[model samples]
Target: MDITSLGGERAAPFEPTFASAAESYLKHGGEERYLAPIVAYFGDRPLKTIYPFDIKAMAEALYPSQSNATRNRQAVTPARAVLMHGYDRGWCNFIRVRRFKEEKPKRRKPATAVWLHAFSRQCDKDGLEHLAAIVLFMASTGARISEAIALRWDEVDLTARTALLLKTKTSTNSMRYLTDEVARRLRGLKEGNSSTDRVFRYSNRHSVNERIRAVCDRADIPYKPPHTCGRHTFASTAIELGMDVKTTMIAGDWRSSSVFLETYVTPRGTPGRVVADRMNVHDFGDI
Candidate 1:
């Protein structure tokens, strides 16, 4: 019998891989080369959509109604998976791989001012004031944890009420115009009047995170691990008062701050229902 009549059809009884075995099987010219013809058979007459179905069903036989044979249980699922693999590894053009259905996203715990204040207060009361200051800076400015630890007193301008937030999680430069309250707290800190010393230089460079975690345990606030709390807090308040996304992006140095604003920092309140019962949008709403 011909190769088409033999066992060369269907899923081919093998896992798809980047190896020559899989590639040769997938290619047009080779021993028992039947993939191209089979694919053409699938594209014959009318085509069927494969999305929103499981690939397991494609291994079975076609249905009784030849009319609905074109609408069989997703014959393209295995091919789609193979295409995605190729696309992921940068081996070939697999454009159909981009057609992904987004699953229900996991929810995250809301970071609040009360929680941060409580965490900082715990640190202060426990005599770990430096770590508390770090927490304060994080909660108010939305600066990254690493950036806060790398801070030198010289980079901070107490007169200008701003911290020269230079290093960032993203490989980009940024500056923080600290909120008045947070700036005042930083200015009043008795970090010795030495311009050359790092602000938290007494401890090892790695120990900044260590002491923050230890203090968090002492403070009794939720221990979800410390990071970018100040950034979160700053974004939260700016969203509440209605700051433009462009302004926020410039201040925070976010590459796509507009996208972040829409996803994380957009206000969900209705002014009409919230204040005077009108359905008009605020100027910052589009921001």
Candidate 2:
């Protein structure tokens, strides 16, 4: 297809391809500047080829070079390194490439635990029980903070002790199995909330975080909310507790295929140590 043969107006309308969308998102500004680059990671190629990370593609765009004799399976070492950095900061998601002809990178990390305990305590102390609903929901349901905030009260089924999850961390809008705590918390919110009517209505991801930070300072906990560390706390704890991977992923909230487990490097709970003088080993272990 020659350029002259085509009815070329100025250029093609910018279809918001993931990459294009990410660029547009960055330009629009706000929370997306942090989010945009992270969203620009996933590419159109087989995911493994894009693995470990797309450092080569990132360093020198994703171009099919006949002259460039590089193995198709080469690992993007630098990009992987960048991904590690991003993961540490809690931006583990696919980042669509904005540059034309370049493949985007994919992110596969989960939140950590140290930050989550801090956030939960912050909620407990701040009188932000409204915010506490969110902290607890994320911790118990393993739902993303976005999903928890966007949740409609009616979506919660107290009788069933499950909250309906949609349009969340995985970007999939499907029914997710939220836990019993989600129900209890929602009920508490319903009893007292009288504002715009969305549970945690004043919440956006950033504001909730900023508020959490303030709460942390007051509580004497170092205030650092790493992107989705709360969610990481939930999933990692779920995994350690022997929760079935499928059941744990009730809402696709946590991608079953991600390296999230590796990054979930937190002890879920205290291991029991038996004292022979006080108790039998059978008490510590299921006899």
Candidate 3:
């Protein structure tokens, strides 16, 4: 019998080392951002040598310098991917990595009218029309920053007052109604750009967020996360305008009204105090 055919199973011709497998995955998988850190963690270790303790140590090491969320997302997720790649290629056994639990803090107050006015005025003063338009679009539509950035001219229908939004979590959200101001701002941005062009020229979410932060600093507003204000502002404003919760949920592309209520809605200045004000005085004779 030939040596190669000794066993019933034929092994892979070439088994990659741990580092090489990771490099291959990062190159072909197209997540180059994690390359440096993955290489630093794994070094020249062979595919079969890594253990769960090593993964735990790496997670613990990352916690001192990075948030638990970032540690798990950036380091742990990619590290697991590298291991999985090696396992799939028959170079190593399966190693399951545990991810960290990341619980975010709740917001005490949503973005208010005062912040919006101040931020918009600052954007106008800075002549950041693109940033201004983005702010306006988010404020009016309750759109996620990702959704707004990915919007194309072809998706906007000014005449019909509708927009075919792409990349929403649910495929059911392709069509959304647009406010006149939202439509107008979109038209303004589209004046010189082609239908195929993105509505905003923002190269990345970070750049847009940086601009918002700068405006917040200049306007003396407390900095919330980039789109926090816009998302909450749209919901709160709609509620204040007497829009029903169901309608507001649809407008915000929220899957559930409970999340919309918990995250976005808050008691206004005197809505609660005045609840019985009209009830007792306006119809006193009937009651």
Candidate 4:
């Protein structure tokens, strides 16, 4: 007992539950969709008692056949976030939960300029000028579908050839310059619309995708979703056309170079030919 007093007053019991930590996390504005399943599985369990194996078991139980990426996103991420919250408060010791192994991601094929031209013509033919403008804006500026949907007429400056993105996935405001072609489209779309109105009248991504799918069918072009056709296309096209990585990242508002390179950039056309031509200094008669 005397030794306990000398050992620096015994640490108070760490008894915070996962549920309590989750509640706090949500109160502070953590996304509910990611934390919902996590809270349900680890409800009322003391943070100190939870282990990596328990997290793995929870992921398997919740999403048995789901991919490792899904497991890491839906299970491991939220659980770790909650535990870290608790640890920050000194309610429990930090626990490291290993994420499930993910397979190498496949490179995405972006929509070619030819495909975009075809799609645009079909949209005009189908009386879908608004839809065409939306796609074009995304393809030119690398704006996400959600950002395109939320764009307002006031945010656009046709004379300046710039548009303001008020809310982005990164939770920051960004300013994107409009391409000459995009500015022309916006000018046509703005003629009948009020300054306060949204540039594209669509309310949600689903409706926009549906309209895009129909146009893709009519255009007879391979159907890439809005994301693949728009943001992905912009990054790939910019890089292929000799835009430097840093400049492209700034234009597209990409905060992370790694993410921009890995997720958005994909090889297009015959780069090997360009490389060979550049290295043609060495000549061999016959090998």
- In terms of TM-score, the best-performing candidate is 4
lDDT of 4 at 82: 84
In terms of TM-score, how similar is model 4 to the real structure? 0.87
**Residue pairs of candidate 1 with colliding backbone atoms:** 138-230, 139-230, 142-230, 142-231, 272-277, 272-278
lDDT string, candidate 4, 1-287, tens digits: 76586876676865789999898878887768778877888899988888889989999999999999999999988888888888888888888899999998776589998999999999989899999999999999999999999999999988899999997998899999898888988888898888889999988999999988989898888888899999999999999889999999998999999999999998865879878886787777654
lDDT-based ranking? 4, 3, 1, 2
- 167-190, model 1: which lDDT tens digit per residue? 577766667776776676676674
Which pairs of residues collide in candidate 3?
Answer: none
lDDT (Cα, 0-100) at 31 in candidate 1: 35
Residues 1-287 of candidate 3 have per-residue lDDT tens digits of 65558766655666466678877776677466755766777788887888877876877775667777888877788788888887877789998888877767566566777877787788879987788777777877888788878878888888997777786866555576777766776677678888888877886788889888888898888886556767788888889888999988887888877788877887678976768665666865775
TM-score of 2: 0.50
Clashes of 4: 0
Candidate 1: 10-residue stretch with minimal lDDT: 44-53
Q: Of models 1 and 3, which has the larger lDDT?
A: 3
**Considering summed lDDT, which 10 consecutive residues are worst modelled in model 2?**
66-75
lDDT of 2: 0.54
Top-lDDT structure, candidate number: 4
Q: Which runs of model 1 end up more than 4 angstroms from their true locations?
A: 1-107, 167-170, 201-213, 266-287
lDDT string for model 2 (1-287, tens) is: 76657876456643323343334334544233233233455533322234333544543444355223232222233234344444343445555333223343333244445555565566766568777667766666666677767877666666767666655555666565546655665677787545336666755788888786777677675554534445665766677667776766663355654555454434433445423433663565665
CA lDDT of 166 in candidate 1?
64
